[model samples]
Target: MPNSKPRANSLIELHKPKRASSVALVVPLKDASRECLKRLARYECPSLPPYPKSQAAAVLVGLFVGRWGDIYVLLSRRSATLSSYAGDTALPGGRWDKTDASLEDTAASFAETARFIQIGLPIDKRRVPLLCTLPPFLARSHLIVTPVVVLVTDPTLRPILNAPEVDTLFSHPLASFLHDRAPFPLPSSSPYHDMPWGPTRVRLHSFLTGREASGTKPIAGLTASILLEVAQIGYGIAPEGFEADAPGQASRRERIAWELSRAERFVEALKREGIRYDWTKEERREREKRLGRDKSRL
Candidate 1:
Protein backbone atom coordinates (compact mmCIF):
# COMPACT_ATOMS: atom_id res chain seq x y z
CA MET A 1 0.00 0.00 0.00
CA PRO A 2 1.12 3.54 -0.64
CA ASN A 3 2.27 5.72 2.27
CA SER A 4 -0.38 8.37 1.75
CA LYS A 5 -2.13 8.24 5.11
CA PRO A 6 -2.90 11.71 6.45
CA ARG A 7 -0.27 12.95 8.91
CA ALA A 8 -1.03 12.42 12.58
CA ASN A 9 -2.50 15.55 14.19
CA SER A 10 -1.56 17.34 17.40
CA LEU A 11 -3.24 14.84 19.74
CA ILE A 12 -0.52 12.31 18.70
CA GLU A 13 2.96 13.13 17.57
CA LEU A 14 3.26 10.05 15.35
CA HIS A 15 6.24 11.32 13.39
CA LYS A 16 8.38 12.64 16.20
CA PRO A 17 11.35 10.85 17.78
CA LYS A 18 10.30 8.51 20.61
CA ARG A 19 10.49 9.65 24.23
CA ALA A 20 10.72 7.20 27.11
CA SER A 21 7.14 7.82 28.21
CA SER A 22 5.64 7.77 24.71
CA VAL A 23 3.75 4.58 23.99
CA ALA A 24 3.45 4.90 20.22
CA LEU A 25 6.01 4.57 17.45
CA VAL A 26 5.46 7.24 14.80
CA VAL A 27 7.04 8.32 11.54
CA PRO A 28 5.80 10.84 9.01
CA LEU A 29 3.14 8.81 7.25
CA LYS A 30 4.36 10.17 3.91
CA ASP A 31 7.87 8.81 4.42
CA ALA A 32 6.70 5.29 5.20
CA SER A 33 6.87 3.84 1.68
CA ARG A 34 9.75 6.06 0.70
CA GLU A 35 11.88 4.81 3.55
CA CYS A 36 11.06 1.18 2.83
CA LEU A 37 11.73 1.54 -0.88
CA LYS A 38 14.94 3.42 -0.19
CA ARG A 39 16.23 0.64 2.01
CA LEU A 40 15.39 -2.06 -0.53
CA ALA A 41 16.75 -0.12 -3.50
CA ARG A 42 20.30 -1.37 -3.06
CA TYR A 43 19.41 -4.98 -3.90
CA GLU A 44 17.73 -6.11 -7.10
CA CYS A 45 14.73 -7.41 -5.24
CA PRO A 46 11.55 -7.79 -7.27
CA SER A 47 8.34 -6.36 -5.85
CA LEU A 48 5.26 -8.49 -6.31
CA PRO A 49 2.37 -6.93 -8.16
CA PRO A 50 -1.26 -7.39 -7.12
CA TYR A 51 -2.01 -11.08 -7.45
CA PRO A 52 -5.74 -11.09 -7.84
CA LYS A 53 -5.68 -14.64 -9.21
CA SER A 54 -3.70 -15.96 -6.23
CA GLN A 55 -5.31 -16.07 -2.79
CA ALA A 56 -4.08 -12.90 -1.11
CA ALA A 57 -2.69 -13.19 2.41
CA ALA A 58 -0.52 -10.87 4.47
CA VAL A 59 1.73 -11.12 7.55
CA LEU A 60 2.32 -8.34 10.02
CA VAL A 61 5.94 -7.50 10.69
CA GLY A 62 5.16 -5.65 13.90
CA LEU A 63 8.05 -3.65 15.29
CA PHE A 64 8.00 -2.22 18.80
CA VAL A 65 10.35 -0.47 21.21
CA GLY A 66 11.54 -3.09 23.71
CA ARG A 67 11.95 -2.66 27.50
CA TRP A 68 15.62 -1.82 27.05
CA GLY A 69 14.82 0.69 24.29
CA ASP A 70 15.76 -1.84 21.60
CA ILE A 71 13.55 -2.35 18.53
CA TYR A 72 12.01 -5.83 18.33
CA VAL A 73 9.63 -7.73 16.08
CA LEU A 74 6.60 -9.57 17.48
CA LEU A 75 6.45 -13.29 16.63
CA SER A 76 4.16 -16.12 17.67
CA ARG A 77 4.19 -19.90 17.96
CA ARG A 78 1.20 -21.63 16.38
CA SER A 79 -0.88 -24.04 18.46
CA ALA A 80 -0.28 -27.72 17.71
CA THR A 81 -3.98 -28.36 17.14
CA LEU A 82 -3.95 -26.39 13.89
CA SER A 83 -4.22 -28.53 10.77
CA SER A 84 -1.47 -26.81 8.77
CA TYR A 85 1.99 -25.89 9.98
CA ALA A 86 0.96 -26.90 13.47
CA GLY A 87 3.23 -25.62 16.26
CA ASP A 88 5.29 -23.59 13.80
CA THR A 89 6.49 -20.08 14.56
CA ALA A 90 4.88 -17.34 12.50
CA LEU A 91 3.98 -13.69 12.20
CA PRO A 92 0.28 -12.81 12.61
CA GLY A 93 -1.49 -13.34 9.29
CA GLY A 94 -4.22 -15.17 7.41
CA ARG A 95 -6.05 -15.23 4.09
CA TRP A 96 -7.59 -12.01 2.76
CA ASP A 97 -11.26 -12.49 3.45
CA LYS A 98 -14.03 -10.55 1.69
CA THR A 99 -14.00 -7.94 4.46
CA ASP A 100 -10.54 -6.71 3.43
CA ALA A 101 -10.55 -4.21 0.55
CA SER A 102 -6.85 -4.82 -0.16
CA LEU A 103 -3.90 -6.88 1.05
CA GLU A 104 -2.68 -3.97 3.12
CA ASP A 105 -6.07 -3.75 4.81
CA THR A 106 -5.88 -7.47 5.52
CA ALA A 107 -2.47 -7.03 7.17
CA ALA A 108 -3.60 -3.99 9.18
CA SER A 109 -6.68 -5.80 10.48
CA PHE A 110 -4.65 -8.81 11.62
CA ALA A 111 -1.99 -6.62 13.21
CA GLU A 112 -4.60 -4.68 15.18
CA THR A 113 -6.37 -7.82 16.36
CA ALA A 114 -3.14 -9.60 17.30
CA ARG A 115 -1.61 -6.61 19.10
CA PHE A 116 -4.82 -6.01 21.05
CA ILE A 117 -4.90 -9.63 22.19
CA GLN A 118 -1.19 -9.68 23.05
CA ILE A 119 -1.12 -6.30 24.73
CA GLY A 120 -3.90 -4.44 26.55
CA LEU A 121 -3.59 -1.19 24.58
CA PRO A 122 -6.42 -0.64 22.12
CA ILE A 123 -5.01 0.34 18.74
CA ASP A 124 -5.74 3.85 17.55
CA LYS A 125 -6.01 3.92 13.76
CA ARG A 126 -4.39 7.32 13.53
CA ARG A 127 -1.45 6.22 15.67
CA VAL A 128 -0.55 3.14 13.60
CA PRO A 129 3.10 3.49 12.75
CA LEU A 130 4.71 3.59 9.31
CA LEU A 131 3.57 0.62 7.18
CA CYS A 132 5.11 -0.60 3.93
CA THR A 133 4.38 -3.77 2.00
CA LEU A 134 7.31 -6.00 1.09
CA PRO A 135 7.72 -8.46 -1.77
CA PRO A 136 5.40 -11.41 -1.56
CA PHE A 137 6.63 -14.96 -0.93
CA LEU A 138 5.05 -18.32 -1.63
CA ALA A 139 4.04 -20.40 1.36
CA ARG A 140 4.19 -24.20 1.64
CA SER A 141 0.41 -24.23 1.23
CA HIS A 142 0.95 -22.33 -2.06
CA LEU A 143 -0.76 -19.15 -0.85
CA ILE A 144 1.01 -15.94 -1.90
CA VAL A 145 1.83 -14.19 1.38
CA THR A 146 2.58 -10.49 1.56
CA PRO A 147 4.45 -9.04 4.53
CA VAL A 148 3.41 -5.65 5.91
CA VAL A 149 6.14 -3.99 7.96
CA VAL A 150 4.94 -1.72 10.78
CA LEU A 151 6.92 0.17 13.42
CA VAL A 152 5.50 0.07 16.95
CA THR A 153 6.47 2.72 19.52
CA ASP A 154 4.93 1.53 22.74
CA PRO A 155 7.04 -0.40 25.28
CA THR A 156 4.63 -0.74 28.18
CA LEU A 157 2.53 -3.40 26.51
CA ARG A 158 3.25 -7.14 26.95
CA PRO A 159 2.07 -10.28 25.19
CA ILE A 160 -1.00 -12.19 26.40
CA LEU A 161 -1.17 -15.09 23.96
CA ASN A 162 -4.34 -16.06 22.08
CA ALA A 163 -3.91 -19.75 22.89
CA PRO A 164 -6.07 -21.28 20.18
CA GLU A 165 -4.20 -19.75 17.27
CA VAL A 166 -0.99 -18.95 19.14
CA ASP A 167 0.62 -21.05 21.87
CA THR A 168 2.88 -18.15 22.88
CA LEU A 169 4.35 -14.90 21.62
CA PHE A 170 7.79 -13.35 21.91
CA SER A 171 9.78 -10.39 20.65
CA HIS A 172 13.28 -10.54 19.15
CA PRO A 173 15.49 -7.53 18.65
CA LEU A 174 15.33 -6.43 15.01
CA ALA A 175 19.10 -6.02 15.15
CA SER A 176 19.52 -9.66 16.17
CA PHE A 177 18.22 -10.92 12.82
CA LEU A 178 20.60 -8.54 11.10
CA HIS A 179 23.61 -10.32 12.61
CA ASP A 180 25.56 -12.68 10.34
CA ARG A 181 24.73 -16.41 10.05
CA ALA A 182 25.21 -19.23 7.51
CA PRO A 183 22.91 -19.66 4.52
CA PHE A 184 20.84 -22.84 4.35
CA PRO A 185 21.59 -24.22 0.90
CA LEU A 186 18.63 -25.64 -0.93
CA PRO A 187 18.56 -28.61 -3.32
CA SER A 188 19.01 -27.57 -6.96
CA SER A 189 15.43 -28.44 -7.83
CA SER A 190 12.93 -26.95 -5.42
CA PRO A 191 9.48 -25.34 -5.47
CA TYR A 192 11.08 -21.88 -5.54
CA HIS A 193 12.89 -22.73 -8.77
CA ASP A 194 10.02 -21.70 -11.03
CA MET A 195 9.32 -18.24 -9.65
CA PRO A 196 7.75 -15.79 -12.08
CA TRP A 197 9.76 -12.95 -10.57
CA GLY A 198 13.39 -12.43 -9.52
CA PRO A 199 16.02 -15.08 -8.68
CA THR A 200 14.54 -18.53 -8.83
CA ARG A 201 16.77 -19.73 -6.00
CA VAL A 202 18.75 -17.42 -3.79
CA ARG A 203 20.57 -19.32 -1.04
CA LEU A 204 18.42 -19.29 2.09
CA HIS A 205 19.93 -18.07 5.38
CA SER A 206 19.36 -19.03 9.00
CA PHE A 207 18.67 -16.62 11.85
CA LEU A 208 18.99 -18.47 15.16
CA THR A 209 17.70 -15.93 17.61
CA GLY A 210 17.69 -17.17 21.26
CA ARG A 211 14.17 -18.57 20.85
CA GLU A 212 14.87 -21.95 22.45
CA ALA A 213 16.08 -20.31 25.66
CA SER A 214 12.71 -18.61 26.03
CA GLY A 215 10.67 -21.69 24.95
CA THR A 216 9.77 -19.99 21.70
CA LYS A 217 10.21 -21.96 18.46
CA PRO A 218 12.18 -21.09 15.36
CA ILE A 219 10.59 -19.42 12.32
CA ALA A 220 11.04 -21.30 9.05
CA GLY A 221 9.69 -21.62 5.46
CA LEU A 222 8.46 -18.47 3.75
CA THR A 223 8.42 -16.57 7.06
CA ALA A 224 12.17 -17.06 7.48
CA SER A 225 12.88 -15.97 3.88
CA ILE A 226 10.85 -12.79 4.28
CA LEU A 227 12.54 -11.92 7.57
CA LEU A 228 15.99 -12.42 6.04
CA GLU A 229 15.20 -10.11 3.14
CA VAL A 230 13.72 -7.52 5.49
CA ALA A 231 16.71 -7.72 7.79
CA GLN A 232 19.15 -7.25 4.91
CA ILE A 233 17.50 -4.07 3.73
CA GLY A 234 16.06 -2.73 6.99
CA TYR A 235 19.41 -3.13 8.74
CA GLY A 236 21.43 -1.87 5.74
CA ILE A 237 23.59 -4.97 5.34
CA ALA A 238 23.29 -5.50 1.58
CA PRO A 239 26.66 -5.93 -0.11
CA GLU A 240 28.32 -3.54 -2.54
CA GLY A 241 27.82 -4.01 -6.32
CA PHE A 242 24.57 -5.80 -5.64
CA GLU A 243 22.31 -5.94 -8.69
CA ALA A 244 18.72 -7.01 -9.05
CA ASP A 245 19.12 -9.75 -11.62
CA ALA A 246 17.91 -13.29 -11.97
CA PRO A 247 20.54 -15.71 -10.62
CA GLY A 248 22.34 -16.69 -13.81
CA GLN A 249 23.91 -20.10 -14.41
CA ALA A 250 27.43 -18.64 -14.51
CA SER A 251 26.95 -16.29 -11.56
CA ARG A 252 25.22 -18.86 -9.37
CA ARG A 253 28.22 -19.41 -7.12
CA GLU A 254 28.78 -15.67 -6.76
CA ARG A 255 25.13 -15.18 -5.87
CA ILE A 256 25.32 -17.95 -3.29
CA ALA A 257 28.44 -16.43 -1.79
CA TRP A 258 26.77 -13.04 -1.56
CA GLU A 259 23.86 -14.51 0.37
CA LEU A 260 26.23 -16.50 2.59
CA SER A 261 28.36 -13.49 3.50
CA ARG A 262 25.31 -11.64 4.78
CA ALA A 263 24.35 -14.70 6.80
CA GLU A 264 27.86 -15.06 8.20
CA ARG A 265 27.55 -11.58 9.67
CA PHE A 266 24.36 -12.62 11.43
CA VAL A 267 26.10 -15.79 12.71
CA GLU A 268 28.89 -13.72 14.25
CA ALA A 269 26.35 -11.49 15.90
CA LEU A 270 24.57 -14.49 17.40
CA LYS A 271 27.89 -15.68 18.81
CA ARG A 272 28.38 -12.35 20.57
CA GLU A 273 24.91 -12.77 22.10
CA GLY A 274 25.76 -16.34 23.23
CA ILE A 275 23.08 -17.92 21.05
CA ARG A 276 23.82 -21.32 19.44
CA TYR A 277 24.47 -21.52 15.70
CA ASP A 278 21.58 -23.86 14.96
CA TRP A 279 19.19 -26.03 16.91
CA THR A 280 20.93 -29.33 17.62
CA LYS A 281 19.82 -32.60 16.02
CA GLU A 282 19.56 -34.04 19.53
CA GLU A 283 17.14 -31.30 20.52
CA ARG A 284 14.99 -32.03 17.48
CA ARG A 285 14.94 -35.73 18.26
CA GLU A 286 14.00 -35.04 21.88
CA ARG A 287 11.17 -32.75 20.79
CA GLU A 288 9.91 -35.41 18.38
CA LYS A 289 9.98 -37.98 21.16
CA ARG A 290 8.00 -35.69 23.43
CA LEU A 291 5.44 -35.10 20.74
CA GLY A 292 5.12 -38.81 20.12
CA ARG A 293 4.49 -39.50 23.82
CA ASP A 294 2.00 -36.67 24.06
CA LYS A 295 0.10 -38.12 21.08
CA SER A 296 0.05 -41.60 22.59
CA ARG A 297 -1.46 -40.22 25.84
CA LEU A 298 -4.17 -38.49 23.81
Candidate 2:
Protein backbone atom coordinates (compact mmCIF):
# COMPACT_ATOMS: atom_id res chain seq x y z
CA MET A 1 0.00 0.00 0.00
CA PRO A 2 3.03 2.36 0.46
CA ASN A 3 3.99 4.78 -2.31
CA SER A 4 7.21 2.91 -3.09
CA LYS A 5 7.21 -0.79 -3.96
CA PRO A 6 8.50 -3.21 -1.33
CA ARG A 7 12.30 -3.25 -1.10
CA ALA A 8 13.97 -5.99 -3.08
CA ASN A 9 15.49 -8.82 -1.07
CA SER A 10 19.23 -8.76 -0.60
CA LEU A 11 20.63 -12.10 -1.67
CA ILE A 12 23.27 -13.79 0.48
CA GLU A 13 25.50 -16.28 -1.26
CA LEU A 14 28.06 -18.65 0.25
CA HIS A 15 31.64 -17.78 -0.52
CA LYS A 16 33.18 -20.06 -3.12
CA PRO A 17 36.68 -19.65 -4.49
CA LYS A 18 37.08 -19.49 -8.24
CA ARG A 19 40.01 -20.85 -10.20
CA ALA A 20 42.42 -18.32 -11.58
CA SER A 21 42.79 -17.79 -15.31
CA SER A 22 46.08 -17.81 -17.24
CA VAL A 23 46.26 -14.06 -17.83
CA ALA A 24 47.83 -12.33 -14.82
CA LEU A 25 47.55 -15.48 -12.73
CA VAL A 26 49.15 -14.86 -9.32
CA VAL A 27 49.92 -18.51 -8.70
CA PRO A 28 49.60 -21.60 -10.88
CA LEU A 29 46.56 -23.81 -10.40
CA LYS A 30 45.61 -21.20 -7.85
CA ASP A 31 42.56 -22.35 -6.00
CA ALA A 32 43.18 -26.08 -6.30
CA SER A 33 46.84 -25.83 -5.30
CA ARG A 34 46.07 -23.56 -2.37
CA GLU A 35 43.42 -25.89 -1.03
CA CYS A 36 45.85 -28.78 -1.39
CA LEU A 37 48.49 -27.03 0.67
CA LYS A 38 45.93 -25.90 3.23
CA ARG A 39 44.52 -29.35 3.82
CA LEU A 40 47.82 -31.20 3.59
CA ALA A 41 48.15 -34.24 5.80
CA ARG A 42 51.01 -34.57 8.25
CA TYR A 43 54.49 -34.73 6.65
CA GLU A 44 56.48 -37.72 7.83
CA CYS A 45 60.21 -37.33 8.51
CA PRO A 46 61.11 -40.22 10.79
CA SER A 47 64.79 -39.34 10.60
CA LEU A 48 64.49 -35.60 11.22
CA PRO A 49 66.49 -34.68 14.29
CA PRO A 50 65.75 -32.13 17.03
CA TYR A 51 67.41 -28.73 17.55
CA PRO A 52 68.79 -26.73 20.41
CA LYS A 53 66.89 -24.07 22.32
CA SER A 54 69.77 -21.57 22.30
CA GLN A 55 69.04 -20.49 18.71
CA ALA A 56 65.56 -19.98 17.27
CA ALA A 57 64.88 -18.93 13.68
CA ALA A 58 62.14 -18.67 11.06
CA VAL A 59 62.00 -18.62 7.28
CA LEU A 60 59.32 -17.58 4.77
CA VAL A 61 58.14 -19.95 2.06
CA GLY A 62 56.84 -17.31 -0.33
CA LEU A 63 55.19 -18.59 -3.50
CA PHE A 64 54.11 -16.77 -6.65
CA VAL A 65 53.42 -17.36 -10.36
CA GLY A 66 55.92 -17.30 -13.19
CA ARG A 67 55.40 -16.16 -16.79
CA TRP A 68 53.92 -19.47 -17.94
CA GLY A 69 51.48 -20.09 -15.07
CA ASP A 70 54.01 -22.20 -13.20
CA ILE A 71 54.34 -21.84 -9.43
CA TYR A 72 57.69 -20.48 -8.19
CA VAL A 73 59.19 -20.19 -4.73
CA LEU A 74 61.22 -17.13 -3.71
CA LEU A 75 64.78 -17.81 -2.57
CA SER A 76 67.65 -15.49 -1.79
CA ARG A 77 71.40 -15.56 -1.98
CA ARG A 78 72.78 -14.35 1.33
CA SER A 79 75.13 -11.40 1.21
CA ALA A 80 78.82 -12.29 0.89
CA THR A 81 79.80 -9.90 3.67
CA LEU A 82 77.74 -11.52 6.39
CA SER A 83 79.40 -13.15 9.37
CA SER A 84 77.80 -16.54 8.66
CA TYR A 85 76.23 -18.31 5.71
CA ALA A 86 77.44 -15.64 3.37
CA GLY A 87 76.80 -16.24 -0.34
CA ASP A 88 74.60 -19.25 0.32
CA THR A 89 71.09 -19.53 -1.13
CA ALA A 90 68.36 -19.47 1.47
CA LEU A 91 64.77 -18.50 2.12
CA PRO A 92 64.29 -14.88 3.24
CA GLY A 93 64.37 -15.25 6.98
CA GLY A 94 66.64 -14.82 10.00
CA ARG A 95 66.96 -15.27 13.72
CA TRP A 96 63.83 -14.58 15.79
CA ASP A 97 64.21 -11.15 17.32
CA LYS A 98 62.90 -9.80 20.60
CA THR A 99 60.47 -7.48 18.82
CA ASP A 100 58.71 -10.25 16.94
CA ALA A 101 55.60 -11.85 18.43
CA SER A 102 56.21 -15.20 16.76
CA LEU A 103 58.13 -16.91 14.00
CA GLU A 104 55.27 -16.08 11.62
CA ASP A 105 55.83 -12.40 12.29
CA THR A 106 59.52 -12.79 11.56
CA ALA A 107 58.76 -14.28 8.15
CA ALA A 108 56.15 -11.64 7.30
CA SER A 109 58.62 -8.87 8.04
CA PHE A 110 61.32 -10.37 5.84
CA ALA A 111 58.95 -11.12 2.94
CA GLU A 112 57.76 -7.49 2.72
CA THR A 113 54.47 -8.62 1.17
CA ALA A 114 52.78 -5.38 2.14
CA ARG A 115 55.45 -3.28 0.41
CA PHE A 116 55.01 -5.36 -2.74
CA ILE A 117 51.26 -4.67 -2.73
CA GLN A 118 51.73 -0.95 -2.11
CA ILE A 119 53.93 -0.74 -5.18
CA GLY A 120 50.88 -1.34 -7.48
CA LEU A 121 50.90 -5.06 -8.26
CA PRO A 122 47.53 -6.06 -9.72
CA ILE A 123 46.27 -8.46 -7.10
CA ASP A 124 43.56 -8.80 -4.51
CA LYS A 125 45.52 -8.11 -1.34
CA ARG A 126 42.86 -9.70 0.81
CA ARG A 127 43.24 -12.98 -1.08
CA VAL A 128 46.69 -13.58 0.37
CA PRO A 129 46.76 -15.96 3.31
CA LEU A 130 49.07 -18.00 5.50
CA LEU A 131 48.73 -21.58 4.24
CA CYS A 132 50.20 -23.23 7.36
CA THR A 133 53.36 -23.47 9.45
CA LEU A 134 55.56 -26.51 8.99
CA PRO A 135 57.28 -28.32 11.82
CA PRO A 136 60.65 -26.96 12.96
CA PHE A 137 63.73 -28.13 11.11
CA LEU A 138 67.31 -28.00 12.34
CA ALA A 139 69.51 -25.55 10.45
CA ARG A 140 73.22 -26.04 9.87
CA SER A 141 74.00 -23.14 12.22
CA HIS A 142 72.50 -25.05 15.12
CA LEU A 143 69.42 -22.85 14.89
CA ILE A 144 65.99 -24.49 15.01
CA VAL A 145 63.88 -22.90 12.30
CA THR A 146 60.18 -23.11 11.53
CA PRO A 147 59.07 -22.53 7.97
CA VAL A 148 56.15 -20.11 7.56
CA VAL A 149 54.28 -20.63 4.29
CA VAL A 150 52.62 -17.65 2.59
CA LEU A 151 50.82 -17.21 -0.73
CA VAL A 152 51.55 -14.11 -2.80
CA THR A 153 48.63 -13.02 -4.93
CA ASP A 154 50.68 -10.77 -7.22
CA PRO A 155 52.65 -12.16 -10.13
CA THR A 156 54.69 -9.01 -10.80
CA LEU A 157 55.85 -8.34 -7.28
CA ARG A 158 59.57 -7.79 -6.73
CA PRO A 159 60.80 -8.39 -3.20
CA ILE A 160 63.12 -5.78 -1.62
CA LEU A 161 66.18 -7.35 -0.04
CA ASN A 162 68.19 -6.17 2.93
CA ALA A 163 71.65 -5.72 1.55
CA PRO A 164 73.45 -6.99 4.63
CA GLU A 165 71.38 -10.13 4.98
CA VAL A 166 70.28 -10.89 1.41
CA ASP A 167 72.25 -10.30 -1.79
CA THR A 168 69.77 -11.19 -4.54
CA LEU A 169 66.40 -12.83 -5.10
CA PHE A 170 65.48 -15.69 -7.42
CA SER A 171 62.68 -18.22 -7.90
CA HIS A 172 62.28 -21.85 -8.94
CA PRO A 173 59.29 -23.97 -9.94
CA LEU A 174 57.93 -26.31 -7.27
CA ALA A 175 57.44 -29.28 -9.59
CA SER A 176 61.15 -29.85 -10.02
CA PHE A 177 61.45 -30.98 -6.42
CA LEU A 178 58.50 -33.39 -6.48
CA HIS A 179 60.87 -36.30 -6.94
CA ASP A 180 64.60 -35.98 -6.43
CA ARG A 181 67.49 -38.31 -7.14
CA ALA A 182 70.50 -38.46 -4.88
CA PRO A 183 73.43 -36.49 -6.13
CA PHE A 184 76.24 -38.58 -7.68
CA PRO A 185 78.92 -39.35 -5.11
CA LEU A 186 77.93 -37.04 -2.25
CA PRO A 187 80.44 -34.59 -0.89
CA SER A 188 82.89 -35.91 1.68
CA SER A 189 82.30 -33.08 4.16
CA SER A 190 79.31 -30.85 5.00
CA PRO A 191 78.85 -28.00 7.46
CA TYR A 192 75.99 -29.93 9.06
CA HIS A 193 78.42 -31.97 11.16
CA ASP A 194 76.80 -30.60 14.31
CA MET A 195 73.40 -31.98 13.38
CA PRO A 196 71.76 -33.90 16.21
CA TRP A 197 71.80 -37.73 16.10
CA GLY A 198 75.07 -38.22 14.22
CA PRO A 199 74.76 -36.19 11.01
CA THR A 200 72.02 -37.98 9.06
CA ARG A 201 72.35 -38.01 5.29
CA VAL A 202 69.72 -35.83 3.51
CA ARG A 203 69.11 -36.19 -0.18
CA LEU A 204 69.99 -33.11 -2.18
CA HIS A 205 68.17 -32.48 -5.45
CA SER A 206 69.44 -30.06 -8.10
CA PHE A 207 67.33 -28.14 -10.59
CA LEU A 208 67.84 -25.16 -12.86
CA THR A 209 65.72 -22.00 -13.04
CA GLY A 210 65.85 -18.73 -14.93
CA ARG A 211 69.33 -18.22 -16.38
CA GLU A 212 71.08 -20.36 -13.78
CA ALA A 213 72.91 -23.52 -14.80
CA SER A 214 71.94 -27.05 -13.76
CA GLY A 215 75.34 -27.29 -12.09
CA THR A 216 74.33 -24.55 -9.68
CA LYS A 217 74.61 -25.62 -6.07
CA PRO A 218 71.56 -27.55 -5.01
CA ILE A 219 69.54 -26.32 -2.07
CA ALA A 220 70.74 -28.32 0.91
CA GLY A 221 70.25 -28.59 4.70
CA LEU A 222 66.88 -27.78 6.20
CA THR A 223 65.92 -25.76 3.15
CA ALA A 224 65.93 -28.83 0.92
CA SER A 225 63.96 -30.90 3.43
CA ILE A 226 61.31 -28.20 3.86
CA LEU A 227 60.80 -27.91 0.11
CA LEU A 228 60.56 -31.70 -0.16
CA GLU A 229 57.69 -31.69 2.34
CA VAL A 230 55.87 -28.97 0.44
CA ALA A 231 56.43 -30.79 -2.85
CA GLN A 232 54.79 -33.83 -1.29
CA ILE A 233 51.62 -31.84 -0.63
CA GLY A 234 51.55 -30.02 -3.98
CA TYR A 235 52.01 -33.25 -5.94
CA GLY A 236 49.83 -35.45 -3.70
CA ILE A 237 52.70 -37.80 -3.01
CA ALA A 238 53.13 -39.91 0.09
CA PRO A 239 55.11 -38.38 2.97
CA GLU A 240 58.85 -38.98 2.94
CA GLY A 241 60.59 -41.37 5.36
CA PHE A 242 57.69 -43.83 5.22
CA GLU A 243 57.55 -47.10 3.31
CA ALA A 244 54.37 -48.90 2.35
CA ASP A 245 53.32 -51.06 5.32
CA ALA A 246 55.94 -49.56 7.61
CA PRO A 247 55.30 -50.46 11.22
CA GLY A 248 54.43 -46.91 12.25
CA GLN A 249 55.49 -43.28 11.87
CA ALA A 250 56.07 -40.46 14.31
CA SER A 251 53.11 -38.30 15.28
CA ARG A 252 53.31 -34.51 15.29
CA ARG A 253 53.59 -34.37 19.05
CA GLU A 254 56.20 -37.11 19.10
CA ARG A 255 58.26 -35.23 16.56
CA ILE A 256 58.12 -32.07 18.65
CA ALA A 257 59.09 -34.02 21.75
CA TRP A 258 62.05 -35.45 19.94
CA GLU A 259 63.30 -31.92 19.36
CA LEU A 260 62.73 -30.95 22.98
CA SER A 261 64.76 -33.91 24.26
CA ARG A 262 67.63 -32.90 21.99
CA ALA A 263 67.37 -29.34 23.29
CA GLU A 264 67.93 -30.65 26.83
CA ARG A 265 71.12 -32.35 25.74
CA PHE A 266 72.26 -29.11 24.14
CA VAL A 267 71.59 -27.30 27.38
CA GLU A 268 73.77 -29.78 29.26
CA ALA A 269 76.59 -29.29 26.77
CA LEU A 270 76.28 -25.53 27.07
CA LYS A 271 76.51 -25.81 30.85
CA ARG A 272 79.68 -27.85 30.51
CA GLU A 273 81.14 -25.12 28.28
CA GLY A 274 80.21 -22.50 30.90
CA ILE A 275 78.15 -20.64 28.34
CA ARG A 276 75.00 -18.90 29.54
CA TYR A 277 71.89 -18.57 27.37
CA ASP A 278 69.00 -16.58 28.77
CA TRP A 279 66.38 -18.16 26.51
CA THR A 280 67.56 -21.71 27.14
CA LYS A 281 67.57 -21.20 30.93
CA GLU A 282 64.10 -19.64 30.77
CA GLU A 283 62.72 -22.55 28.74
CA ARG A 284 64.20 -25.05 31.18
CA ARG A 285 62.57 -23.30 34.12
CA GLU A 286 59.22 -23.26 32.34
CA ARG A 287 59.49 -26.95 31.49
CA GLU A 288 60.31 -27.77 35.13
CA LYS A 289 57.31 -25.77 36.29
CA ARG A 290 55.00 -27.68 33.95
CA LEU A 291 56.38 -31.01 35.09
CA GLY A 292 55.88 -30.04 38.74
CA ARG A 293 52.29 -29.10 38.08
CA ASP A 294 51.64 -32.39 36.29
CA LYS A 295 53.09 -34.40 39.14
CA SER A 296 51.00 -32.52 41.68
CA ARG A 297 47.81 -33.18 39.74
CA LEU A 298 48.62 -36.87 39.42
Residue 91, model 1: Cα distance from true site in angstroms: 0.8
- Which stretches of model 1 miss by more than 4 angstroms? 1-48, 107-109, 113-121, 181-202, 213-215, 239-298
Give model 1's clash tally: 12
Query: Candidate 1 versus the native: TM-score?
Result: 0.56
Global lDDT of each model? 0.51, 0.49
- For model 2, state the Cα shift of residue 50 in Å: 13
Give the distance in Å from residue 171's predicted Cα in candidate 2 to where it truly belongs: 0.6
**Candidate 2 positional error at 39, Å:** 4.1
Report how far residue 137 has shifted in candidate 1, in Å: 1.5
Candidate 1 lDDT by residue in tens digits, 1-298: 2325434322133232331123334333333333443453233334332334225577877765433333467787888888987887778776767766666566556655543463333454434453456656655454556677666544444556667778877776554454333332221222132233222334343345455666555555567667766766755655222222223321222222222223444335345545443323433444455456657768
lDDT (tens digit, per residue) of candidate 2 on 1-298: 0122222111111011332222233233444344344453223323333333346676777765444444568777767888876776677666666676654455445333333321222234233444456767655565667776656664445555667666667777665555333332223333123222321223333333333353335566567667767766655766332221112223333334434445665556456545554543444554565556657767
Clash count for each candidate, listed in order shown: 12, 0
lDDT: worst 10-residue window of model 1: 249-258
- Score candidate 1 by lDDT: 0.51
